[model samples]
Target: MQSIRDRLEIILSRLANRADEKVYTKLYSEAARAAADAADARQKAGVGLGLLDGAIVSIKDLFDVAGEPTAAGSLMLASAAPASRDAAVVRRLRQAGAVILGKTNMTEFAFTAIGDNLHYGTPGNAVDASLIPGGSSSGAAVAVAEGSSAISIGSDTGGSVRIPASLNGVVGFKPTARRVPLAGAFPLSMTLDSIGPLARSVTECALADAVMAGEDSAFLQPIALAGLRVGIPRGVLFDETQAEVASAFEGSIRKLEQSGARVADLAVDDLIAEMRAATKRGTIASMEGAEVHEDWLAAGASVPVDPHVSGPLSRALAIPASVYIRTIRRRTELAASMDERLASVDVLALPTTPMVAPSIAAMTGDEALRDKTEGLLLRNTQAANQFDLCAISLPMPGMILPAGLMLVARRGHDRHLLGIAAAVETLLGR
Candidate 1:
């Protein structure tokens, strides 16, 4: 209780005094302080709520906070009326006694992983102010990286959480699509959207995920590194991957091997190619995302959605409904093939992002360059959502550009995945 109160005070001070415009879109100052005080009282009365009691956390703007408009980093919804109820995740977190500091800024409509929202202003990477912070969960990751919160709850549709965490050198976990409730989170791709956490370590993520899932926060049990089977699936995921990310990932693998883990160079290229082909050159998020926003975009709301964002959503309108259905059916059939391919391996390991953070200046205002860069950033992490797998990105040491080594497991293996990640975090720190 005391430790939590101390951290809350520091975070409050930082949020209050910091001059960074992009760090947060809103801060629940009075509510957060009151929550902290109540938690302290519970501790004094010997009636704690749960493990996260008094823990300071941040929510993405897209999550419903009763009576507050879910701007979702968009100008379109900026003046919309407040929500009638709290998002399910928000309620669960509150039940577990979390102190939500405020809603952080994000990519408008959670559209791009590039993290630029000309309307709300994207967060600058904590590692490098000039570079772009990975998004649509940009500010959520930044809050933790910049010391405004201990944990952040964000939605991952196409590497939103992990991409930002990777670029900012923090741990981001995307649980299986079904693990966390998404009832009140604004949808990007309802089928692919999953809620998760970004924090300094896997242990913290494990605890936060549990709370989000309505479970008691428990300490993560570290798995044995020796004899752990790790697979690296071959595909377009590696094409154009930066040497910096490649070197760091490869080096991390060697360390794991030395610690007795079995690293397999798997031949899953055909599986990956078939899956990508099934989607017919466009992403699932693009198709589903268009349906969610087309009505509003057509109504002339004066939204600040960038060309990069509007282009894809507009293009998705042309996709035949049959195309989406056929693609989904094909992907569903291919899930068995993916399952068979991974049956032998305990987990898959890869770079969280194909490249390090690119300067905002380089991609900003250049539509072609932004499109190319966005694809590169989302290339690796997007696979997790498509394949319905639980994934996590752990910060890899020894790099000028921030790098993250991502670990993936079969869907519904979230707990096991976190345990493995905790073990890897320990080994990497060694």
Candidate 2:
């Protein structure tokens, strides 16, 4: 392999001629060059950091990088006070000797799953520029998919990271919410926010996730596929799933079965319905997000912000405090129930997004269509956040348009889930 510095130069050259501002909020070219040079020097001296040393990485815009305001894909906070220090994850990434490429674009306040940023402009899907790149980790996935970065760190609050990764045809992992510290990250929903990684392979995601979670950066060993129980939650989540995505997901399951994995239908539709009922007032994420952005919402019309973000937040704010409290309490009970229900299976498999990437022009042109599309996109993946589970989206092979086969495991089983994903990735010949 070429030296880290040389590889970085090639990536920079490729990006130099592209209009990538929509994909990257800010590029750390000077900082990246310095870090790459250091990594190269360390290599020459026969000294180096672990797995992440000399690796190029991109961060979602919500993370604070000392001396810069975390705009988080919004113009409203473009002039916000600069951060006094790097975010916890950012500091950790540096300590691991990872080269910081840039801050990738995201939905304003990480609110929407559609991935279009009116302020920073939207980043087109990595496979097809005209399609919506699934968000709020839009640029993070695009950066990795476009090979501008070796890996990308992104926040997953209600499917942001996995959705984009699925649409972009890459690996995206959402660890259990508390696995990684959230300090210095712009909050969307404190309750649901999780930091994770996107990369070309499951191993890269695992390594980056371990570093961010403050765990040992050791290579992951694939768990045996034989006799591992894989559950298929076959209900509302599968509703309206596009034909191509459905076919691809089914094909993936067949491949796993052929590899000696045990596959069965785990009936969780009732539990899903109950969970939905518990949050009828609003989801835990939207309710908590409203609280985080109270001042912004209070500023109302004076603050120019995306209506898609503000509208849902405004509605969530109107929900009675008592209702929000009841929902939170009920959610805890539901999450526990989900954990118990999942004990029979090693993991649950589903389509990451019910549909493939849709044209950005179509989404932007029709308001009703946009809302409907966003709901469909978030349906399957949001369950992991709602129930507090570790989930990963692996690109399904042989699809005309990219889609993800999501595998969800119980909370705090991030490492186990990554191992399973690695084994499955190999089975898929990815």
Candidate 3:
């Protein structure tokens, strides 16, 4: 088999001019070549390597790579000082022998769930060219979906990682927030931010998560659906799912049941209520993002901001400080609720995105459509962040367009979540 780096070069050459906007920035060919050479050399040395050794991984532009300026999909940072060191997670990946392919585009400052970035350009949806490839980890998913890399690294403050992974038909994992370090990565919400992997398979995501968390990948047991308890929350998460998405999610559940997993309906009324109330008040993402970017905005750096990206982010900043404070308190309360409520179940399953991928035309420029799309995109996945739970978005089988069946676990139960996800993946045969 060709090394991941060799495959990436072929994919890059094939896609170089096919779509003008799918990828906004790319590393110099020489840099990629050198990484590829080093990977091959290390393999030939007969040294046991890390999980990602020789794997080509694409990163969202928000991560700081030494000598390269962190753009976060905003042109405003084009002239900012180049980073002198890699983000902690990036350093870890490099130490594990993963090749840094290039930085992928994202929603400006990782603010919006919609992947449309006007400055760096939106990554075209691989399954359907006209549809939106959910953001802000847009290009990260695109890189994997289009086979440009074996996996992509993206941050999920509130479903940024999972939304795109769902829409693009890949696996996305968001470990419990505190389990993965966030140092050196650009912040969206310091409290909610998590670095996770987007890969072709759930097992691959598990491997990546192990590397990020500095855990032993060998200890992650394969999932066995037999006798496992799966919960279906009986509220808002199911309220607005599109027919296709609903059917796919339901079908996946039925398959799991048939494969010996015991599925039950559970009420998370209070959690849903808190999430609704929190949305009205603005989320941790919006509040913390405003705090982090305050200085940049004060310096009149808005001109280079992508209208599609900043338009939504600017609205987030409009939220009152009082509301933000209350929301943070509520987030803690909800986290406590999740710990108690999910104590009995192995995993809570839901549709990763409430709706399927929307048309790119529908997501761009129109404020109402943008808001609607953003809300729908992050609806199911955001609860994981709100409650400080670990979650994974696994691609459901038989969907023409990518849709994820999300599995969420209780706080600090990262390993258990991976086990459940692995079992679910086995049951689903994907």
Candidate 4:
């Protein structure tokens, strides 16, 4: 096998233009080389070889890696004390024999779907430099797309992983909330936060997720497409979808149908409207997020929250306790309702995002436009989070610019979802 150290060197060399301080805020060169050396030594001794042995993996900045401050893509936490030990998942990754590349950048506190960060630079989309990479897992997705890592770990709350993966044309998996430990990562929404992997393929994500969960590699069984039922909601998710994105999504539906899968367009507006109402009622992330940052902000650990993030947090801080509690209850009710609605389908299908990646210029020039675009991007993927569903984003076919076809399954069915995704991926080709 190729030496792990050599692979790290090769990966780093490709990152020469990965958008400075954005995709990767830190590079654990010496530490990674040391780990790589150990892996190679173990190989020679015929021991210490695990599933991810010698693989290079990049971590989202939110993950706590011992001895490094988890800045979470903000300068506010830059001076925070180093972590005492690796986050549970990071420890698991190491145990799986992977080389920890470094911490990747993200939206400040992972508060936004858009990747822009005032403190740390934004990682430009690899598919289109002018575009804003989908985030708060922006750097994690870009790192994989840029070939800087074989796989990257990221946190998903409200479509963070799926949005970025869709925009970057890579596979993004958001397992059930409790599928992986959340002990070490900085919190965005305690209720919705999930840890998952973004990689070139579904099998890779499944393998990484298994290791992170401290479980044996899942046996991926492919479900035949002939009898598979893919549900495409007729409204809400498709509302305001750009022409190009809609075309790509429709094309994928056609392909699946031709491949023998039965595509059903269901009247899902009620379920979707309920999700939107939940957001309007109150955001769980913003509510819990305010609590999480209250101390730090009061002490001035984070002096000035980014405008985009501050708007929501400030409102959340003022949210009456009753409102927050009500919203939580409403969210649970909505999740149950949505899951129940999926009884007739094998999986839910929709565009991963409402549009192709928009130029960062368009977003930067008009504040209102930026807000609007970001909201649209989150429109589709956030449903899965709201419904507490396990979801994956796969690239759609014949796209000059990348678009994604998302597949969502009921929560707690992550492994089975991955298997279904793998079957779809195969139908679409690698």
Candidate 5:
């Protein structure tokens, strides 16, 4: 095997060759070199950290690295005070001996689904420059896809990690919201935000997740496909889905059935509708996000924030506290309903996004289209967050532009979901 230092150097060389300043907000060249060297020395001495030792990992910009201000993909926080300590997850990653590659770009405040960042140039889709990388985890996905980092950590509130992972053709795993501690990360929604890892394969994601969650990095044992029960929620999730994406999803289902997995329609439209109704004033994300940025929202135009992020957030300020409280209570009840509903099925499957990545130009040029596209992109994946479940998005087989086949399981069933994803990935020959 190549030495850790050797691998890190190659990645550093690649970063040096490209104008990747927008993709990676910072590059810990000297620090990474030192970490790599330490790992190599430990290997020579027959002592090493756990599974993630020597792994090249990149964290989302929202994570606080000691002594640096967490910008979170906006100019507003660029001048904020430096963090006194590393984010919780960052500290955990370092403890596992993972070499930090530095911070990747994200959507402003991690509020938007599409990956456009006017302050830091959007990191184009990994496969096609014209298309979006999908965000708010845009740079995390791009860094993994471009081989700059073996694993990129991202924050997923509503499909931030999965959307970018799908568009960029990689694996992204979002554990239950509370599984990994959230301290030191710039907040979008305290209730909804989850920190997850995006990587080239499900196993890699599992390893990173285990390390960050402070669990033992046990090797994932792929669940046998033959008796696995898979649920396909076939209602609103399919609406306005591009032909290619829909076709790919069907093909994956058929493949799974042929492999002896049982597939059946699971109606979740009503449950989702009720959840949406409860949050009609605004999503839990928007309401909580607005509260987090109340000072900035009050500053209005003086703040010079992304309007896409600030608009809905500002509107959410009008949402009465009674409504916010009601929405939270209703969401809790609905989440219980969803969990009970999911008990009959081993996992719920769907397209990570209703459609594949649209061109960055088209998304940026048309406001209405962008809004519509954002809804479509977040539709299928957001349910996992709202319902307090674990989910993984695996790149589908044989797509010119990438799409994802997402599998969601009950809350705290993260390990099971990763095992199932590994099984599906194997079946799909990924």
Candidate 6:
């Protein structure tokens, strides 16, 4: 069998041109080499290696590393001081023996769902160069899909990780909020922000989540599909999706039934509408982001913000403080309602992105297309954030490009969600 390092080197060579868009700001060749050396030494010494030993992992630019600047995809922070120490999650990954491959690009300050960074060129979708890779975890998904890294860490506030995974044909897993630590990482929305992984398979994502969240990896056992009750939201979620997405989702539902899983259609329209209304004023992300960047804004340093990222972020900051406060309270109510409604189901299913990836030209030039793309990207995934649910996006088979099937479970049930996702992946034969 080929060693992990050899596999990584091959992938890097194949996907190097994809990096022309600056999806990765730096490459950690030295760290990767060092990891390979250690793995070889452990093998020779007859010592047991960790699950991710010698595996190459990519980091989103938003996370701090001892010597690198956490640019968060903005020229505004180009001159920012280097981090004195690794972020908490970085340290954890290092301890698990995973190599730090490099920092991947992202939407500036993680402000938008559509990945188009003006400062650092936008990361193109792996499936189609003309389409977007989705944000703010754009490059993280690209790194995994293009095979530059086995897995990549990404922060998801409102679908950042899952959106790109859906667009790029990879697996993105977002644990329940607060399951993973947020310290030493750039803040988007403290209330909804979560650190997770993007990888090629559901199993790989689950392994990364286990290490990052300090959970037991043994919990990811094979699960039976029979009797697994899955809820399908009947209202806006189904109505709002495009024809292609609707057809693909229906086909997936049929496959689950063939595998002997029980599927039921449930209505959560009121909760979905309430959540959308809550976001109109401002989300926890917008409120927290304004506070985090207040110093930069006050010092007149926000001028160089990436236009693609800044437009949405500026609008978020413009929300009234009273509205922001009301949104937070409403979020709590929404989470409670979701918990009660989904108590009996093992998981809830939806289309990860209501529409497939749009052309990069259309996204950047047309405001209407951009808005539609962003809304579609977040429509299904945002509910997970609002309800503090654990969710994962797995690529749906038989799609022209990459489209995703999102699986959501109750908050704090990360382990259970992973098992169900594993079974679903088996049913899809991917």
User: lDDT tens digits, residues 1-430, model 1?
Assistant: 2556666887777666767678789888888988988988888898988868888899999999999788888877878899999999999889889999999889888988888788877688998889899898999888888888889999999899999999999999999897899988999898899999999989889989998887764767778999999998756677888888888988999999999999988776787778879987567898999889878656644745676778888888778888999888887877777777788998999999988899999887687888898888888888888888899999998889797999999888889899999999998998
- Select the stronger candidate by TM-score from 3 and 5: 5
Worst lDDT 10-window in candidate 6: 12-21
Instruction: In model 2, state the lDDT of residue 407.
Output: 98
- The RMSD of every model to the true structure, in order and in angstroms, is 1.6, 1.1, 2.0, 1.7, 1.1, 1.9
Q: Write the per-residue lDDT of candidate 5 for residues 93-133, one digit (tens) a residue.
A: 99999999889988899989999898888998989988999
Off by over 4 Å in 2: none
> Which parts of model 6 are misplaced by more than 4 Å?
11-21, 315-320
lDDT of 3: 0.82
> Which lDDT tens digits does candidate 4 get at residues 46-115?
8975788888899999999888788888778888899999999999999888999988889999989889
Tens-digit lDDT track of model 3 for 232-271: 9968778878888889999999998888888999889777
Stretches off by above 4 angstroms in model 4 are: 16-21, 44-48, 296-302
Instruction: Give each model's whole-structure lDDT.
Output: 0.87, 0.92, 0.82, 0.86, 0.91, 0.84
**What's the residue-level lDDT of 301 in candidate 3?**
63
Q: What RMSD value applies to candidate 1?
A: 1.6
Give the range where candidate 2 is weakest over 10 consecutive residues by summed lDDT: 295-304
Least accurate stretch of 10 residues (summed lDDT) in model 3? Answer: 306-315
lDDT-better candidate, 4 vs 5: 5
135 Cα displacement, candidate 4 (Å): 0.8
lDDT of 6: 0.84
Model 2, 1-430: lDDT tens digits are 7888989999887778775468888889999999999999999999978679999999999999999888988887888899999999999999999999999999999988999998889999989999999998999999999999899999998999999999999999999998999999999888889999999999999989989989875568779999999999998899999999999999999999988999999998888898889888798888999898888687774557898988889999888999998988888888999999999999999999999999999998999999999999999999999999999999999998899999999999889899999999999974
